[model samples]
Target: MFASDRLELAERYTELLATEGVVRGLIGPREAPRLWERHVLNSAVLAEAIPDGVSVCDIGTGAGLPGLVLAIARPDLSVTLVEPLLRRTTFLDEVVAELGLAHVTVVRGRAEDLHGKATFDVVTSRAVAPLERLLGWSMPLVAPTGATIAMKGQSIHEEITQARRFLSTWRCGEPEVLVVGADVVDPPTTLVRVPWADPKRIGWPLARDAKRRSGRRDRSSVKREVS
Candidate 1:
């Protein structure tokens, strides 16, 4: 839900999505009529799952679904919208400027581009990819104490099952399926939260890559030698 002070900004964004968004093929024309209930409000509801005052990265954020919407709803959050498409980033940048959302940053790149360079309290996505692939793209950007929270549909359980091997290899804690915005959105929103099993030992592959870069043996070989 948007604060009273920010409600007008949200409305402006919705209008843009309905007009410019549809004209540019970002949003289908059919979706324009229901942009409020189906897109804007639905995305705004995601705020309930996010913590206060956190750095968030929304990857593959086409037209900045939950990312831009969150910025409008929660000024306390620092949001980064990551999209590879120049067109999408263009629209996103324009909206940010028009809305005067100082807290938002638009990054024109894929989720993998920022893997080693940055990390945030939350890495999020909507209709970006399946759970298996999403983990690869999202988890690396997640800070040690943070998580990858993605909006999912009814097929989430199947996706989770498919991602079991990835979950284990990445050493992620059990994925928690949560329903947020129950009172706000009629159908509500389903989210899957994936955190590191042990914050102190997160980023297994990144650690290995770092060891290689430093010309050092990986933990496994080092442990074997000590044994």
Candidate 2:
């Protein structure tokens, strides 16, 4: 559907939220503000960056923003919403079941313990923590060929730099700021975050490459991944 007009997808997404009630029920408490634009689209924006026919995990997937939405949008991509909070996990499971979304799994656990338990082609995270700390959680859960992406705002440049030390420790790939697509036709919004993880920091250089390309498509990276 993304290959088609994105506006149609946005309309469907609007209806998807209104009828399903996952985003509001899971997030947007009476105390919290700015639910729709901040959390929903922020999470959904990842849908554009994710490759087809891959497995993705959302660490601290509180209400299953990008994770669940992407799952609904791309059935071919297997998605796992990993939320340590029991209430959130229960809410996520119920949402998946009610929505009848396929290839979407709910894993109730933390990133630290998930090591050796399972891995994924990609990992999406937001509101988790700093870049380096997020790396510890995300890197352990991704396949060697996959990468970990954090949804960030404000300080993309500093986060990338701070993530450098941890990237060295994890030997993860490079961290880059990609884009988060919006429903509007405005200049493509940037994911402005990091995509990293791999052995000996092979993903190291990918950080800059992804930044330079702004998450559109990296022929060299894809070619290397195939070889």
Candidate 3:
């Protein structure tokens, strides 16, 4: 499902993950044997849920799991890999440069730090945190009309149930569970898709504050122009 150039890049990425990724403790050596199926392809399959030509931010992108994989599989996307650790971001930056992925940006910061600073059409995470805490960190990064997708394990439904209170408070629509890559990858990949609801109804404090700050900045600019 990838172009020739992208296919080559994916191959190189797999090799890097198996070698340096393991040596650096980014990935366990045991995982190297199944890196293609379990890690690279598993992450790549999530591309099925993402639309073409939209911006995406992958939170806590250690070893670039789904983030770099998505950039390889779908060249149409503009991807930002948000990682907090210096070692992980270092790895990600090198891989992006090596792959010549012009559309990918490696940002060294936690998701919470980006709130009000940036937002995207879609926000993503894999094995980041529990659904409740994940929503707290991810929801604020998604545009009002966007969605947050988490690569979850089999207990996805239970997590959703537990996150119901947070979901209601944040005005998130009902979470949709999806099994992607049914044909290409064995056992498929499970995902939890949470679309954003009306912010006014949900009472999103950060978004409101951001809006007010933006308005103030605009007014200041107008005053400077008048002066």
Highest TM-score among the candidates is held by which one? 1
lDDT of 1 by residue, 91-133 (tens): 9989999999877877787877665656678888998889999
Among the numbered candidates, top lDDT falls to 1
Which is the better candidate, 1 or 3, if ranked by lDDT? 1
Residue-by-residue lDDT tens digits, candidate 2, 28-84: 344134444554555565777788888777888776766776776676776767777
> Candidate 1 vs. truth: CA RMSD?
8.6
Candidate 3 C-alpha lDDT tens digits along 81-119: 888788888899899898898878777878887776656
Off by over 4 Å in 2: 1-26, 29-36, 182-227
For candidate 1, list the clashing residue pairs, or say none: none
| Candidate 3 segments exceeding 4 Å error | 199-202, 208-227
Model 3, position 84, has a per-residue lDDT of 79
Sorting all predicted structures by lDDT, with the top scorer first, yields: 1, 3, 2
Task: Between candidates 1 and 2, name the one with more favorable lDDT.
Answer: 1
